[model samples]
Target chain A: MTTVIRELGDEQRELVLNMGPHHPSTHGVLRFVLHTDGEVMRKAVPEIGYLHRGLEKIAESTTYPGYVPYTDRVNYLEAMFANEAFSKAIESLSDIEVPERAQYLRAIAGELNRIASHNITIGCITMDLGAITPFVHLLRERETINDLIEALCGQRVTHHYVRIGGVAYDADDNWLKQVEKFLNHFEAIIEELDNLIVYNEILVKRMADVAVITADDAVGFGLVGPNLRASGVDWDLRRDMPYGIYPKLDFDVPIGAGEKGTVGDCFDRFVVRVRELKQSCRIIRQCINNIPDGDIIGNVSRKIKPPKGEVYSCVEGARGELGVYVVSDGTEKPYRVKWRSGSFSAMSIIEHISEGLMIADLVAVIATLDVIAPETDR
Target chain B: MTSEALIDYVKGLLGDKTKWADPEAGDNFLTVASEDWKNICQTLATDKKCSLTYLRNFTGTDYPEDDEIELTAHTFSYSEKHGLIIKTRISREAAVCDTLSKIWPAAIWYEREIFDLLGVSFNNHPDLRRILMPEDWVGHPLRKDYKQQETYRGIPTTRPA
Candidate 1:
């Protein structure tokens, strides 16, 4: 923690600085109003909603199946998780049964998306900390994941692949072979990222002991995913509340051990994401090896109207627990839809923790949180 | 604890304050009066039997037919491994309720968002302002009767037919 400096008279007047809405490091259209006394920040107020698209309002008008494409736009980086969460909500409401092979396919797509998202998180964090080489290297590896996803689904970024009953399409033998080939070399790529950036002394010194969040504060502020795990709270929605084929697969949830500094600092958050990349790879390998042979889509009605009921379903997204709450009116269109995004809660805690930190370190904290603006403001 | 036991425990605590409890719903839905919203939330967050510390999601639903706006909050307890959906209905004319930002800081943003899009107000909120829309926006867009403006500062606001 940085010490607050106080001086008398006109020389010590507090300065107000606006940090984004167009700044490159913000990753999107996010603005922070900082009230600083010299180098130490007195208060940092986050002004979000610049990228708000009224996705919830849009969901009310679109039918259950028609809204699947819009779900991809909610979180562009990890669209599969968003797609799965929305689809699962519909499935629970209508009591639709998904095929076993489709569950495995969805898990494989989700893990691949998780790896791609983590690559961006690590790359952006390192690049923000003044290391440019690792970011390019990580993105180069991400290209391979993108290629694999493109082979399965037509689109690369927003793959609206998860349908209500199952996935949009089945992966052919060629697609499965390409996934196996990518997994064979993925472990070494994670190790290369570890050596190139994670172990670098400058990166550790810059991130360690910065923006520490205790376990109590993490829960009180509703922090989820890596941010909450980094605070040393052993909670992951995928492990605790098993969904789809995640219960069948075996993997470990990494928690912050405070190796570089105290628990829940920037370093632990960065390291947790790095470790998760390996876990995602392990899940992917298991899913690909044991994928069953059956029909991809289940027997669902063409009308796509759910009974008059409300359901809330969540999946462990790239950022955290992405939940979808849908209220149906026994009609073609939904009555109400609310998206509980992980980034929204992650961004809410920044105002409390940003006080008493240097302005430059604020960027590091934001990067480590890995909040996508569209998800937060959606 | 199971969701049924959790709801029973909350029912015992709230007594008359608990308007309705449906454990069979997707997420155990519990409705309470708007007056007891703050205290009930405080008890839910702090009580050992039902310590729902995690505020997962919060939003408002508009029901013009009922002439009320329903504010719903989804809370989960990591220690207990249970969840409950708490809701309160207030008349649209006076859509004000007590703020839970003190109990869970995450509610501040949700309350602001509801206030922004649905026109719900939270009393004693530290910063109760529009979140998703600009401060000077004309109407709450999520309401059933909300109409789009033709223009904003001389620029066409609607899509061309």
Candidate 2:
């Protein structure tokens, strides 16, 4: 093979490079305009909106009930959270009461979605860092969770399972049994994943102490979920705000202690998600064991016309605190709907923090942050 | 501090700057003049009694009847565990307000988004450009009166039926 090369002059100038919009590691058509001095990155400006479908604009035109499926497009990775956030916004606006059984189902489905999301986060991060085996292993576990979710909700990616008042359907005993079996098996697989990737020497070196974000910075940037907890913020909407059935379920909110690296580093972020995976399993097990029997749906009006008011409903999604702000003008269609996505703010901090890191480490930073482009652009 | 106390604190801090306070809206909702938007945001974010360090959401809603666009900001204090919503109304003709990007870095993107979608401009924003739309795209799509262009660069803008 013939190679074409250009000789560098004595003058040193920064090289500006475009990373994605099509690159696999960019994760959903996200582009990074990187300024690099050789291997070191001087600045990384993330150019998003490639996936912007005007979801907020769509929400305004669609009726309250008609918008549930559209919410899935906001963050397909954790569609249940978006569904719950939108539905909860409607329920709050219309004064509808969700049944207890439905609340339990929401918790169960939400936790399972969290696990599935974390699987992709962990697997993709590992794969991006050059390890292929762990990605396959993680995907194998993810497929099992997807099967369980598909059985419960009847769809895989955009499971429009949650409704305005409650879930689409109640979990049968068979589905609950499958979830219980999956949780038991998932516990062992998580340990296997940890052994395979977390403690691996190369992965640790690549992630640990790279792209460190302080607790102050995390709070200022509005980081949430594992990213915020990894920085030692000790805040989780499920625990702090106590929405849905989160209060009834007992599970530990994992915070990064920096056991293997500096606190708030990329490694800590990765570890936080792994710990959350285990915690999610614990919550799912508890939800299955103590699930109460009742109506799946609530006494919500089928017309779905909320009075003239506004409401903001938030859920601790797989990525972070996903909030849906809905404004109703005494009409079937919402006046305006704003999706306050955690990934949007998380992605904003990249420019500030990417100044000193190497070009390769930026990938680790991006992966650890788990910035899903659709959610950010939405 | 409880949400009520936070509301009282903000009401006392801003005093006459606050146009109205809606206690029924929940989350300490208050509407203030566009001129005092930045000052109120700074106070809410930095004040110890109301350390609303988190800028949860920033968006603009078009109210055609009022001939103004209402800019709403939701802030949360992790330490206090309380939240507040502040609204500022700007005339639709000159929809400009001081940016809170300085107070909360997260507002940078939010401001750009509001600017891109609602045609509201945020003065003093470090980088004010269309975020979710193409640079060449015309009109703010989220505006109530916006009319979708038939074509862009001679390409059909709508799906062919």
Candidate 3:
């Protein structure tokens, strides 16, 4: 149906505003075709792909080892998760063995990456809800984790730390010590954030019961990560489809059963990510304790050619399921390489969730969905 | 679940529409006719035994050299049944498939994406706009023989080969 925007007066015509593919508050280069009558939105249809780098097409040309750097650029917030997803998918496709030490190291970095990503999720959600303090506070903690990534791979945000088979560098003594110190402070900050955002009444007024989606719609729409779990569909790739050392880790997959108001709203989505932060910490602590010493890199085939078959390996990305489908013709180059991006599902929620709300609320909804534009565009 | 039973079960449900045993259980193919797209998806999804609720992704690959366009639907049942990925191809002429967006609303953008990058049109998509590329863009870039000389807005690009 063509959305009909009627004018309030002859002088005051309905305005169709171009939000942006360059607005920083848009989170990334996400443009919105927002149909509004001044402040209230009639319809807000998101226009994506302003930052489309076409990584999947690029992967078909690059070697298996050459694809690692590309994943770093896919999801800039959760760089390690994208890296791990690519590396793990290649490892699974080739049936290469990653050592226990490497696996443990991968788990630590992955969970830390999850924490950093969650911090952004919670921080940005709160900021979008008009609480600026939480955004800065959360970023202050996210930078330390970025420092750890920098120590490993020399770059912070776009970390090329994970290779095809295993992590590029092992967590040395100092790195472990730094991680332990951060974990202590991280716990306290999370507590403060809970008090500030989760329990706050003003945040609840803006978030709770806004843009509610049912469990049926959640599954039907294939919402993943905290979004799916927030809607009460217990489909986590880590536990259900075990990859790496996640199955061994002791933690609960947190769900949002409408603590404040109802499931599948902005607050519940934020709560799910907040709860996941604690669970991610639990997994990281277990990883730190049981981490054995061994080689970091695994035995990836030199030529890195798989059988003339298709293999898709999906890991539990910080946002959702991140998979890479490789169609190799028993050659160094792949016939096709498709990156199953997390944000694709996250952004798809816009179709169902953006129907009836103010334009500002639409931004709030997108921020709560926590989609990375590069990941979606790629 | 045993591969044999999983294979047999899928065969019974899909009948002639799916080729279960022909492609091994390790992320391989089963051809699907364009007519059978929605039924096959609904069967794979709604059947309580095979609650293939989680859609991993839907992507298409264009093989201009082979004159075949491939579309793959990677799905898994969350209620502890099985995971099956349907791989199908269409001869370059009738490269259209009925979209499963009605069955799985998540397929909206995904089908649009396949439509966007690979030019595999999804018949009856609600809003089949170019998702990742500008609306005015000419040819799909992911096709094997496709070119990316000028962008959607007619801005010419020069990059070292």
Scoring model 1 with DockQ, what do you get? 0.66
Q: Residue A164 in candidate 2 has what lDDT?
A: 88
Per-residue lDDT tens digits for candidate 3, residues A114-139, read 89888888888888778899889889
Runs in model 3 with CA error above 4 Å?
A: A1-15, A37-39, B1-4, B21-26, B150-154
Q: Tens digit of lDDT per residue, candidate 1, span A225-309? A: 9999999999898899999998898999999999899999999999999999999989988998899899998998877988777
Over 4 Å off, model 2: A1-12, B23-28
Q: What count of clashes does model 1 give? A: 0
What is the per-residue lDDT of model 2 for residues A27-65, given as tens digits with 9 covering 90 to 100? 898888887777998889999888899898888788889
Interface RMSD of each: 1.9, 1.9, 2.2
True-structure lDDT of candidate 1: 0.90
User: lDDT, candidate 2, residue A132?
Assistant: 85
For candidate 3, the lDDT comes to 0.79
Task: Output the worst ten-in-a-row residue range by lDDT, candidate 1 chain A.
Answer: A1-10
Identify the candidate with maximal lDDT.
1
**Candidates sorted by lDDT, best first:** 1, 2, 3
lDDT of 1 by residue, B80-143 (tens): 8999889999999889999999999989999999999999989999999998888878999999
Error of 1 at A250 (Å): 0.8
- lDDT of candidate 2 over B1-161, digit per residue (tens): 88777667777987877765553432337887787789878987899988899988889999999999999998888999998888989999999999898899988989999999999988889999988998889999999999889998999989999
Weakest lDDT window of 10 consecutive positions for candidate 3 chain A? A1-10
